[model samples]
Target: MTDNIDIDRSLGFTIAARNARGRLVRLGPVLESIISAHAYPPAIEKLLAEALVLTALLGATLKDDSGQMTLQAQTEGGPIDLLVCDYRGGELRGYIKFDAERLAEMPVNPTLFALFGKGYLAITFDQVATGERYQGIVPLEGATLADAAESYFAQSEQIPSLIRIGVTRDEHGCVAGGLMLQHLAEGEEGRDRIHTRLDHPEWEHVAILGSTIKIEELAQRDLPLETIVWRLFNEETEVRLLGGASLTKGCRCDVVHIRDVLSKFPAEERANMADDTGKIGVDCAFCSRIFAIPVAELENAGETTK
Candidate 1:
């Protein structure tokens, strides 16, 4: 089945397309997930959705089964401290630092460099099961995430690709959704074929259809996936199915994990916390879940995972 199959729901949908060879995939979504860690306004909420969509789109291209992808944006700007999202199996969980003043200063035309003034953007891939990880540091370029990501791909993988990303608030004005489309590396013949299609009258026609996707419609309208595909592609265009997926928030936090982190802490800090309470208090970064581990429990559990 094509990965781009439509979803029928009262909320939103995601559709992905990968060619027969699976060298590339285009994924997009209308997300309404409200993570409990922090509250965000409409604009930043939209930005987070775009970031999440981008992560999953990139994740679909991974070649290793155990590998995971992370997208991190850190800036000195207030109201928007940072945005981080991890993608695996189309599932995601992310958090952003929010600042009202910084968000107010955001111009309509934002470049990655300007938005994240004097900051770094990183993409990390890890084989969690095997404990091997690789990270790439990217200098922010252009004004949008698309520009930085495209540059990263060209520099890191030496692949030529075109990426377009859009984020908007739907009509109801409650949620955020995003769409990403990319053309991957193919031989001259394949490239020529794509160019020919782009030049075709229908190419502009498709772009026009895509333009109809207002942020309002995406946020408020609960359109079926099939309807969305039809709206963009005529019946004559064969949209070969590749796969479909749903994204949910997740975090890695457990009592043992908390204890393991506490073990690495300076004994002085541990002793201080122990003095205040019977145990040490730890919080998970991603979820902000608090775990109070008494010194007695840590002693009984051993200093490490058993």
Candidate 2:
């Protein structure tokens, strides 16, 4: 990497610099692990990567100790009817329900319109302690995933933000990365104070600088997230780092959960999910892990699969 960024690391981080400037950057190594774990195809991988990166950036902005955020999208006539992701405590899991027949005909690289056709993006946040929920829904008019995210803030949340994401795959694996800049109040990031700067010149200047970023540069896992920020806003003063979190491939699917879900189903329905060996088996869309429950477990209570 031309920039003095440490590319060897994979932790995702956000920068809340001075002057009401904020940027969130996620690297490939963290994202690629998810790609390998899920084994999604190229087009789906790209979509998932973009959604994951966007989720991390947006989720961090509103993260709380016991709050969970979810991002979901759906369309009328697209291959995927629904795509949803849940983020909480620096962890994420997402699933896509697609029309397999239609997906088979899609190109190796499909655009948002091609994959999802026309749809809406919905973001929801819920806090465990307060039982408080916040939701913002926006039309998916933007050609890119980041564009749709930006539109959500403009039309729903009323925040001035710019999100850009890019994904690339080589022989080794897929790498997805993105950066976002938001016009928070002039105070430093993570601070209690909030300032509204309607005429701030820095927002526009940063927007122009962010626009010049190339897809290749963002996809480089060897480039540090800080290096990307420095390359874009090195001249700016009072640059501050608002701390960061690491991301990994994780899914909540396990034998106990799977058996519980099967127990809720009637015996007849459960039988349909059973294999010839009289074991109930199902695949988790989030992580592609398979859980199998034996007949004894379905009949009464039994040990779980590892």
Per-residue lDDT value at 140 in model 1 = 64
Model 1 TM-score?
0.67
Across 130-156, the per-residue lDDT of candidate 1 in tens digits comes to: 788888877766667767886776676
Candidate of highest lDDT: 2
- Name model 2 segments beyond 4 Å from true: 1-19, 37-39, 104-109, 186-201, 261-276, 298-306
Please report, as a residue range, the 10-residue window in candidate 1 with the lowest summed lDDT.
16-25
TM-score, cand. 2 vs. native = 0.82
For model 1 the local lDDT of residue 305 reads 44
Worst 10 residues of 2 by lDDT: 1-10
Q: Candidate 2 — what's its lDDT? A: 0.70
Model 1 residue runs over 4 Å out of place are: 1-34, 63-65, 76-79, 98-115, 127-136, 154-174, 187-221, 235-237, 263-269, 273-275, 303-306
In TM-score terms, which candidate is top? 2
